[model samples]
Target chain A: MTLDVLAAGILSGGLYALIGLGISLVFGVLGLMNLAHGELVIAGAYLASLLVVDSGWDPLLALPLAMAGVALIAYPLQRYLLTPLLRGDKSAPLVGTFGLSLLAQALFQGVFGTHPKSLPASYADSGISVLGLRIQTIYLIAFALTTVLCAATHLVLTRTRAGSAVRAASADPATAAVLGINVSTVYAMTFAGAAALAAAGGVLTGVAQSFTPTSGLPLLLTGMAVMALAGIGSVGGVLLAGIALGVLQSASVQLFGGGMRDVVVYLAFFLVLAVRPQGLFRKAATG
Target chain B: MIRSTSRRIHALGAAALLAATAGCAGNASSSSGGKNDDGGPIVIGTSISLSGTTVLNQIRDGYLLAVQKVNAEGGLEVGGKKRKVELKVLDNRSDTNTMVQQVRSLALTDHVVGLLGSCCQQNIDMQGQADALKVPLVMGALPVELLPKGKGYTWDSFQSLADGAKDFYTVAAGAKTDKKTLIVTNNDAQGISTGKLWGATGKKAGFTIAATKAVPTGTTDFSDVIKAGKSSHAQVLIAAMAPPDCFAMWKQMKALAYKPKVAVGVQCAQTPGWGSLGKLGDGTLVQLNWSDTAGLPETNLIVSKYGKKYTNLTDLGSVALGLHEATILLDAIKSAGSTDADAINKALAKSTTVSAQGPVKFVDNKSVTPTFIGQWEGGAIKQVWPAKGGSPLASLTGLG
Candidate 1:
């Protein structure tokens, strides 16, 4: 009955979709799950917090700074540490990413000490009446921004020259190279875009909840779940899965006791996977 | 004459053996360091979370401040030996494994005479190490059940509160009404223990069983729990989760526009740490044992002096608890006449402390201290229960 709750749920789902997009994109391009997605998200969040809370910069302004920070770290990390493993075996990159995730978790814990610090802003508390329901101003802003970012991402992946190169590389890298595409650049760009999306998600997260170094684990797990539920490499599927997961979560908490909420949602996920192994929204090919 | 000679020779041989045994015991005690008649500096190691979880920081700051204050006044006097009491702090990072490892390192590497530990009951199993080494450990804020039931370990571990579960139940029993209470707990040891206490108290307090819920820590969606409550027409909601989870849940309650008769529980009303929630925390009631009004004069003095050092809050209880740790250890060192582990532990077992939390005399349970209850009213923490010595109790309003 509460419209605000529905709005909030939808907005929350959007954020989840953003996170899922990153996971799916990584899997689509690299054919591997970047287990460190959560850490990257955390890195982005902390970077944003440092800028806004410590340096006294505007939170929105800190977004790109955080994205750039993640890219810088991710680039070198991928080049030096992750690349060597990629050449060896398929599971090698996956295992290395896991190690990197652990290392990132430890590093953040060592530095931040686990107490959650929030980005300073009045907008977090500011709200207005919309349709006689209480709607937080930040949630509205986050939703609009997330939507715009998702639209722009879809455009970049489907419409432009770089987008074509990235798609070709994902589909058939050898064919893309034969067709005169710099497959390496496309791979790097895809990873960078995934990192940037994670950063954007992190910025929204900073507004949504108080987070610490340990906050990354749940995020990474959730991201992976969304990607798996949606079928990795399906952008539209990720979006649908994110919303479905959120609604399922809301419904779970509503009907069943909280003890069974997670069990039920996970059960639904398993059932869906069993019924439609390619996911409910999975397409044979992108037109 | 022959019998007397024989007895004297036997007595001489027995005396020799007794002296040898005493030598071994003394050597064992002095293995860390020789017991100087003029007490040098006595170093006590603490493996507590100095940073993780703001509550732990509040405790650490309070503990350090007390140590500093005591040292400034003068060193501890034990058996006519003057020793400067020094607290060696190790950041346990809120991990039990880390705490255990830190304790071992502090004892073996740093050669500390005594060890102080985290307030978490789950980690109190480390007392086995203290027992094995014949040392004293002053554990802060563990539930009484963590210790063996109907038994006491006088040599190894000492607790501040004996009946913490009783305190929680007492608060719940006194607060509950005829409402169908919904109990939500985190999936952790403390959370589970809290749920059990609240469940027992809810029934005693005249609350009907609506639904008992458990959420994994860091749960974001509380809708399912809320929906279950909504369907059951739950009049009261009791959550045994942390502040952040509680904050999110309260916000969701607002978002759902679901206002029951009242929502109350351990984390929502009891914690002073959830101040970040602002208005979302209003009408939430939590029960705690420490308050400035009920605190000793020394606690207020300590807070006034050292309050400016941290950006975060330093609660009256945390400071008092920290002071309690220091005073209790100091008492043990004095009573034992030596900083030897076994001797100091013996002293700790019998010691009584007049701390900021008031008189904390340890009996069997380690979780029950001179207790009280507090509520967050209009963004300020106020003492609410145990009206014998504190301010007038505030009535439950708004949601109730």
Candidate 2:
């Protein structure tokens, strides 16, 4: 394959990793699947649209606001609505999250109208040539930003005291609660953090691609593919999985015709799952 | 006092329910005819995709605009009796199965004399229902030739894909480009059909079919296609796909620095979303079914009435399809002289009404409309073919 094709795939993987990071954080730390994760991502993009179109802010300038706005919404949603349901059957929250997705779609439609919207960024279409290999400037920025976020997230989960509390609650909620850690609050914060990441992914996606209220489903599928490949919780593994998925897609397009690319990538995903039940990258535990 | 209040409330609720039923039931109590009765207004129903990925609100608006205009003129004359045409619309929510169920209900329960068609696959699926239910279905925004030759129940008046292929070749002949062409299309029915036809037409026009690639609907990667375009060094490019698919491909093409001297996105570049790509979208060509610059019959009326909403030829094309489809159905009703489904089916097969897209006549339940080539200049589309009415064809620029 040409350097250009490989470059496109690698750049695309950065976004996939960003999408996967949120879902894995919630699923591994809070033990909540967050079926509406895609909606959260889309919600972030919608927030960016409001600022960029109405307030005339650059998309990059408004991205942090989008992330924060979605985090605020997610924090309250987890605290008030999803947390209560999580106590009952797991399916309750799953069902509730689905309903939330529908509600989010309706709200997006009502506020933004049903038209497809894009957060216009000058860098969205601009590109840079790195030693003769052309790459989209927006994608290059996204890759750099994702690397920073991944590093920061990894540090928060391992090095910080709050991260220790989150790990304690995730490992054993009852024990963590007895140890003076508010399990519910930890869960809410974890969900909120995951949401912020998802929103960041959404803003990047909005800059690169056009989005509608229904844009989340494709992203959800991509996130799931990365999560499945990465196995649930390894931060580094998630990044690798994202890159793997992005490369798989680009490679598929290069080797097979573009018509059969999806078929090839999905078939490869199934094969990997069947062969390695844990995942492609998960480390085996020692007794 | 409580007992009296409850009785009054119950009585009012019952009275309101009865009145609503009576009104929706097509005035059956009056001899003027039930909603479907020839004596009353002739009802035509459609289940349009108002939401979801395949939103056709422009097409829906077109139907409403035409239907409302007809009603304003005191309705259509059927069988020497004056009848106001009432349109029954249901939001299909962009579900094909839901559209099927609604179309059946409209024909069977609502007793609408004829049916209107939605765009793309929905219309394709509705054709079978129209024939099985024996209700005349008037449809546009889809090439009728694509449908399997069916009974005389479904009549289509839209542009032809083969015609689009021919038109593209004719224009590209004059533009400066090597005769090598790369054809990329979606794996879906319409994409494959357009690719096959356009490839043949390109070959006939003395251009070599350098490479052809087909991708799925939700495809976001165009690396393989880009590689092919680059290696093959095809001077001409044709991608027939949905708008989203084209959007991704367009960006990737630029990122990889593969610039075709002449490129046409058959179905994808027609969307207003293409404008969001900034100057990267300039000089990208698309085949048109309707253009404000073409001076087609009733185009001014269509544009002026719904100008604010549609705002572009790409969108106006669908609206014109909906309007033309509705116009033919209305014309058929007048010719049928009865709201009877069978009679309407017969008359629709023989329908010949001049529409915004010009004279519409169905031969074998299909009619072909003119196809024009257009280009995205800045944020708007300009008709660039048919030098008599449109601007001269411009060379490809600003792609890289």
Candidate 3:
């Protein structure tokens, strides 16, 4: 493969993995499929875009502030809003998250008015040349940050007391609760962490592409595909899945017309899942 | 109370106008069979994007202004009776599906004599619905693929300038100073359609199509496409995308120092946002069908009046085209005499009229007069082709 294509594939893969990490973390620990996770990303992007476009903040400067705002809402959303629904049937959380997705979409359109807005980030286009491949400075930076974040998540799960509690809850919430692990608290924190990762993905995605209110659906699908291929709760699995998915998707577009790219990627995802439902490299369940 | 009274007034006024026009039409028909008398106001129907994107409002206003001017001049005489022109307006909501439904609604329900205002490409595909219903669909801003085909049902869709869009060989034929050329297209129907158009032209133009990259729409990171172009040694970068994408690309192009002598773009280049590009938009030329700076008064007056109605000022590019569509439809209706769809369709098929745009006439294969090109010069889009109808020629400089 040409370095150009490879670079695009790899950089795009990194962002995909970041999104996957959020989806997987929530799905694995909370036992809730968050259809609204993509909405969270869209919200983060619009939040940052509003700051950059209307408030005149640099995108880089707005990222942390936007992340904080998301964090503030995300934790409460998980605790008060989501926890009440946990008493209902299994579909309650799923239905609630779906409603949240629609709500977020409506709110975005209501506030932003369905027009294209941009962050106008200064480093948006910055890139450096190496090995005859022009690597975008932003892509490289995003890739690096993704790796760091994923690694940090791994460390948190394996090394710290919080990691122990989170892994304990993911493996067996009832057992962890019996063991005095504050399982309810773990769920909220896990969801909050997922939200933060989603916020990061949003900032990176907005910086990488121009976004609108309607952009969340496709991005959400892509994130879901990556998560499914990577396997739930496996950080490293998500990375491999993202990379493989990104490369295959981009290469398919190059070989075929744009129409076939999605079909090809989804088929590949199905094939991988059929062959190894647990993922290509499934880590053992840990507590 | 106010709403009820206004509704009653509107209904009475509309019914009375309809009856009077029908009586005038019957008398005219008795006098001269079917030939136009050159003295009746025509009825035209337009379904444009009035609210979505705000810019569409400018375009709708432009068409209304054209109608206002024509009516003020006592309407065109058709067959032997004086009839005042009327415009039946519908808002398409900027949705493709809605556009098709609205066009059909305007034709079958509203009974508009002629159709106008399809500035976007996808919306023009809705013209097929119009064609199926046998209405004269006069669109001013659609690409070649969406143009009326085979049947004469799709009548004269005009362009403001002679567009060089069909010439793919220009890109291929031009000797490239740099080895690589990257084609960046937005991941949407318009962007894909433009990329296809460029590919057809580029293959003929003689430049090697090194890479065709699709950047997902609303993508914040453009590094992938820009780097791919750079690595490919694409000295020429062509993007078929919106203003935001271009803004992102240029910012990246500057940071990466990827300078090409011939960096051309398609779509939204003539928009006011491109003017904000300052020097960056400088060396970049685009294929355009019309520009306001060409000293076409019919064009200028449409802009001035439309500006007052829509955005309080007439600087938006799409507005001028929308107005042109409205006027052309009005011309057909005035020429046809009655508000009958069949009559107006025939009039549009045979009529030759001067638009706020250049002189326009329909040809065979459901196509209108050919298009020309325009470039943004010093914040004003100036026509720059054909030598005769073109803006003053300028030497090609590198895009920095």
Candidate 4:
């Protein structure tokens, strides 16, 4: 593949990493697969559209608020609804999150009117050349932002007192509760944090591509693929996995044409799962 | 315990029988194609994508408007009696399986004599359901060329892809370009057919096909496609994909600076949402089934009723299509003088009616509507071809 295609794929992978990180975080800590994670990503985009599209605010200016808004919405959901379900049937959270996904899709359609929407920006459809290689300006910004967020996420989990409580709760919730860690609060906070990351990715994705109410399914699958490839609890691996997916997709399109791009990536995903169920980049279980 | 279980099973059987009888009682007056003894409204059902990736709100509105106008006139006259038209609409959410199931239920369970169509590829899928159920189905939005030959249960009244492609080439003949074309389509039945038809039509118009690619739906990256177009130096670009795919491709095209002199986004750029792309959406051409300036029948009525809600040419065209399809179906029902499916189908074969898109007469189970090529200018689409009360072509400033 040409360097241009490679660059595009790598940059697009940054957004994928951002999307997968949230899903990976929730799965690692709570041991609950948040089917609504894709919705969370879309929720961020829709939330930002309120500010960016209606109020004419810069997407960058609206990103943090959108993140905060989605986090606020996710915190209580995990704390009250999802966390309690985790204590009961193992499948309840899965079903609950799936329900949330449907509900979110309905609410988006009802509220937004089913028209495809995007966050307009000066950089949305512009490109800049670096080292004689051209890249989309929005994707570049998204890549830089994704790297910083991933690093911040890693540092938060590895270097803070809050991080220690999260690790303690994730490793053994019952023991962490006995040790006065307030496991429920830690779980809620972790989910909320992951949701914020998804929102950030959502805003970036909106800037890069158009989204509809039902756009979350593809994104959810992509994130799931990244998580499956990267394994749980590896922030760096998520980034690598996202890039790997991006490169594979780009190369497949180049070699086998566009029709085979998804086929190749999905085949790789299935093969990776079959061969290494624990994942290709499985580090020590952070939990 | 065994005796108790046997008693419970008997109770369950009784309950099931009771529910089945109630269902039959509820549908006793419902008939698929015979005279209605209950003197109830004639039910015409449609399962459309009201909220999904491809929303047919305009088409649905057209169906409702036709129903409303007929009901306002005290309903359709059937077998020397006037009966109100009852429209049962179910949202399929753009899922083919859901659409199929909903269409089946509307025919067998609801016992509607006639069915109205959904948009795009769904209409093609609905054709099978219509034929298998032996219900008369009338639809627009799907091109005549894409309508697969099947049992004569489905009737399509819309612009033909061949006509649109020929009209596009006629428009392109006046434009300044090398005529080296690049065509990209989504890898679905409609998309594939569009690519082949347009490519063949372009060759007849003396345009050379430089590159052709078919990508699946939901493809966000178009760099490889762009690279092909650039390498081939294709000045005439044709893309047939969904709105979101076109949105991303348009953005990437501008970003990568491919700079095709002429571009037509079939089925993609027609959405009102294209205006959201602002300047990037400008100068892109779309095939319109109806234009206000074309002086089709009931244009004034459509404008008067839905002028405020639908301001753009694309949305208005969709509303017109809906109105056209509904009028044709209702007129067939009136001509048949009964709610019988076979009679309605026969009547549709001989249908000659005028609606929003002008005179429509079924020839080979299809009615070819007038085709008008429109271009996005400023934030709205204007009819730029047919040059009769239409605007002149503009440079593709969106690419630059």
What C-alpha lDDT do the candidate models reach, one value each? 0.65, 0.81, 0.66, 0.88
Q: Name the runs in model 2 displaced over 4 angstroms.
A: A1-6, A53-56, A113-115, A284-287, B1-33
Comparison by TM-score, 1 against 2, better one: 2
DockQ of each: 0.09, 0.28, 0.11, 0.37
User: Which has the greatest lDDT?
Assistant: 4
lDDT of 4 by residue, A1-287 (tens): 78877888899999999999999999999999999998999999999999998999999999999999999999998887777778866776787788788779878988987778878888999988888886789999988999999898988999999999998998999999999999989999999999999999889988888888988999999999999999988998898889889989999998898999999999999999999888878774342
Stretches of candidate 4 exceeding 4 Å from the true structure:
A284-287, B1-35, B95-105, B108-110
Off by over 4 Å in 3: A1-8, A54-56, A72-117, A129-133, A151-193, A247-264, A284-287, B1-58, B63-101, B117-124, B160-162, B166-234, B241-258, B268-282, B302-315, B365-399
- TM-score winner between 3 and 4, please give it: 4
Best by TM-score: 4
TM-score, ranked from best to worst:
4, 2, 1, 3
Q: What is the C-alpha lDDT profile of model 3 across B1-400, one tens digit per residue? A: 3454345445545755775565335322111112123333354666666433432645655666666777788765555555665666666545677678767766666555666755666445756776787877777666544564535656545542224554323432343455355788887765776677676666655566778877655443455566567678777677777766676677567656777656666764645545444455665667655555555536556555554543311244455666566666677777776566678777777767766555556666334534445555564455555445565544334245
- Per-residue lDDT tens digits for candidate 4, residues B112-197, read 88999998789999999999999999998888877889899999998888999999989887889999999999998767878999
lDDT score for residue B293 of model 2: 83
lDDT tens digits by residue: candidate 1, B181-262: 7888997766776677777766775667688778877787666666667778876777777656776666555555556655
Clashing pairs in 4: B33-B340
Give the 10-residue window scoring lowest on summed lDDT in candidate 2 chain B: B24-33
TM-score of chain B of each: 0.78, 0.89, 0.74, 0.87
C-alpha RMSD values across all candidates:
13.3, 6.1, 9.7, 5.4
TM-score of 1: 0.78
**lDDT, model 2:** 0.81
